[model samples]
Target: MNQENRAGQWSRARQVASPNQDARPHGEVSLLLLHAISLPPGQFSGDAIEALFTNRLDPNEHPFFAEIDHLRVSAHLLIRRDGECIQFVDSDQRAWHAGRSYWWDSALNAWRSKLNDFSVGIELEGDDCTPFTKAQYTSLVDAVGWLMARYPALTPQRITSHAKVAPLRKTDPGPAFDWAYFRQRLSQAAFKQ
Candidate 1:
């Protein structure tokens, strides 16, 4: 993959624009939020996730989809189970990923609310109870390394999980995610960059 970000879009990811994005209030991009998702909760490899992000998901397709199809949400990128990356929103724009969330920004030395204003959200194709694939980790590290290089404000310490940002409302990139391993891979990739 090319280790560069142009026009807020990564060359490695397949471009799939979603209408659920808009301009950032302050054009700030600092935090990297990681999340987990699956179409039918645990099922993988389906167009349901894409459809949902694009506001094209048919609620009648599934009982669970019927409940969440009305909600508008989109992440900056999504890493599939096979390690394919898809971009739903440009990095320069604000994606509707984080809802009612907050994070502690050590750089600012204070709690920052409304994470979407300055965060890039990445969705890994998996559920809370399942482990992410090695390919996903590798792709994520590469993507994050490029992002960190492109955005000077982003740091390894600033990278966080959605669960931490929205503790009571969300639990994703959950217990099954290997933060230590991810950090190790990211460090290695950053060193190479």
Candidate 2:
């Protein structure tokens, strides 16, 4: 798959613009945040994810939908279980994925709050209890490497999980995600380029 991100859009990804995005404050894109999500909490391969991002989700479709359909949220990219990548928001823009989160930037020696202002969010088609697919991991590594290349401030250490940033309200890309394996594969992917 082509990994080049041109003007905040990946060459190989399907674009689906989401209204839940806006200009990034200070035009900063320094952090990469990983998140896990599945419509109805566990199901996959449905239009619910896209619909939610685009503000078209039907609350009557499911009970859980009723609770979250009103939320305005989106991510920069989503890697499906089959490794199909979809881009909902431009990387240069602020997607409403991370809410009330904070990250400590060692390079700047400061604590950054409201991560959406400086971070790119990627959502994997998964939940907290289930392990993500190999295809997803491969796509994620490639995507992360591409982002790191484009954003000089991003690095392996700067890439973190949603749970870590929003410990009080979120616990996704949770324990099921293998951090060591992802780091190793990401290194290999980066090395290849």
Candidate 3:
């Protein structure tokens, strides 16, 4: 891992940064939001999704993007189907992918936390029913390990699927993502460390 290059935080090639980001709130990087996306909902293997994050999506280029043309969003990282990891936002920064989301925090009532401010968002290339490839899982584990190593405050409990955080509005890293398998992977990684 190239410690100097934050881009090396993941195991794949790095892409252009998204402008839709800001500083983490209260310097609290305590949560990890897992998500999934495909350019045309179910299609894969295209640069359209990457372009969208960088604010360069050509609406007319694809009919599926037409509806979301006016919307702007971004995540900290995206793990392609083949497990190619791309970083759109830095760990120290906040990504704008999560909107109107909340997570449990015993100290606060109706705790509303800005996704960008309190958590790191990672988008996988898949749909609701699609099973994530083994490579993607391996890559996700590695990426999360890197982040946890860099930020001592991050932990497995902090990691959660998009559905868990925004149950009413979003669902990704879906049901097929087998939380137990990944949780075991994380525990093994932590043990190894």
Candidate 4:
């Protein structure tokens, strides 16, 4: 099918699906996993990355998405460079973004064994080396607002970066992400919207 056809298959008011999802586990979605991505690492949105997730990436087209052209992965939502939000998984289902991770509950001194079990994963369209756009941040905050309102289980404290869990394996929602700006923006937007 064409890109428009595939994209239209899961278009909703707040998200678009990927036909790459399944049911979420039986439990509350308490955690929010933060992530970042770009088909060629620094490049912005394009049909190539979307095609990659839909198992349609061309191996010889670009060296960036070429290496992992065979891998299959999707997140619950993808915030584009312009702040557009795309959904690949439902809020009630698990998105296979996080693989082996933990959340800090320092009081308990033990890792939360099931971080991904009941979490909503959001992937931003950017990499560790790139600076995310202001529009992206606003759009991300808007999406987060929508999610928190939809799922009461999610709180500010529950939102976390992928790097927090897989320190050695990943570095997303990286240093350029500006956590403080997002937090403040989220807090402000939450009150107004």
Candidate 5:
């Protein structure tokens, strides 16, 4: 597995620094939230996702873009449809992926809020209707394996979907995301839960 440098960047991914990030609170990174997105609703393979994350999205390009152009949001990484990994925020920093979300921290025996303070977000280039590509899954497994090795607090159980964390406001990495298959692959990659 490739190691991230002191600056918190993973050696394997293409770095695309995002302004929509900040230092992680307490330098704590324990949760992994999976998300889904596709520009123009279901369309894929364009610069739109990158544009949005980088705060360079032109509002006039699409109606949807106009609606969300003002929102400042980004994930730590985006695993593209063909398995290409793009790192927008460093692995050790906090990306603004989870907004007003909550998680049950079993270690603390309490419910944790402000999930962005302690979570890493990985967005898959997909939608609720389309099945994620095999390539995407393979890359995701590799990235997750690398993340698990770096952060001891990031156990398999700590990884979850965005929908679970922000039920009222978000539903991503949705039905099209096959959790069973993903877990199977993670295990196959020797990532113990």
Candidate 6:
């Protein structure tokens, strides 16, 4: 779970190999969904997030773990508060992050569902109440740049939040997330790269 180098994966990230993933339906990645998560609520920087994504979380470890230990979800990448990057599912594959989600598709001129078929998921090591670290944002900006270079269709405009896609069930990367700051950083990174 600590692979340093691998094919079809980001070079800078540590690979954890989550099983909650599969091949993309049509080999297209056009969206980037940012999500916020923390083990046991507002806590930060633990193996619990990785354990949960890899289906190894012990329900007895924590009350919150018991509630979500049944989930089989994974994100393509996770950016930790310390700015460490972890690759769970390969970006070319479909991570089970977006469940029963939909978004407006301008090309199709309609609301589209099944976002996992064509979207890359990134989980920020944070909660709705805590402000994400500057390190996390830096790592995220770098990761997004790397992903953009690989997936031409994944523009900054295409990047969104889990809350936007699943309003009724989720509100992550929430009010504490500064969209303006992240966007400015992303814009600056784009120019530098």
Give the number of the best model, judged by lDDT.
Answer: 1
After superposition of all CA atoms, the RMSD between model 2 and the true structure is 2.2
lDDT, candidate 6, at 59: 98
Instruction: Say which candidate scores most in TM-score.
Output: 1
Q: Model 5: residues >4 Å from true position, as ranges?
A: 1-3, 191-193
User: Tens digits of per-residue lDDT for model 5 on 78-181?
Assistant: 99999999999998889999999989898999999999999999999999999999999999998998888788999889999999988998889999999999
lDDT of 1 by residue, 66-92 (tens): 999889999999999999999999999
How does residue 125 of candidate 2 score in lDDT? 94
Error of 5 at 12 (Å): 1.6
lDDT-superior candidate, 1 or 6: 1
Candidate 1 global CA lDDT score: 0.93
Tens digits of per-residue lDDT, candidate 3, 49-118, equal 8888888888898887888877788988899999888898877788897788888864444576666787
Cα lDDT listed for each candidate: 0.93, 0.90, 0.81, 0.76, 0.92, 0.92
Error of 2 at 180 (Å): 0.9
Give the clash total for candidate 1: 0
- For model 1, name the residue pairs that clash: none
Candidate rank order under lDDT: 1, 6, 5, 2, 3, 4
Model 6 steric clash pairs: none
* Model 3 C-alpha lDDT versus the unseen true structure: 0.81
lDDT of 4 by residue, 132-164 (tens): 899888878877876786678788988999999
Structural similarity to truth (TM-score) of each candidate: 0.96, 0.95, 0.90, 0.85, 0.96, 0.95
lDDT at 161 for candidate 2?
Answer: 91
Which lDDT value does model 1 have at 117?
Answer: 92
Question: Alpha carbon lDDT of residue 17, candidate 2?
Answer: 97
Q: Which wins on lDDT, candidate 2 or candidate 4?
A: 2
lDDT per residue, candidate 6, 1-193, as tens digits?
A: 3332234599889989999999998999999999999998899877999999999999999999999989999999999999999999988889999999999988778998999999999999999989999999999999999889888999998999999999999999999999999999999998886
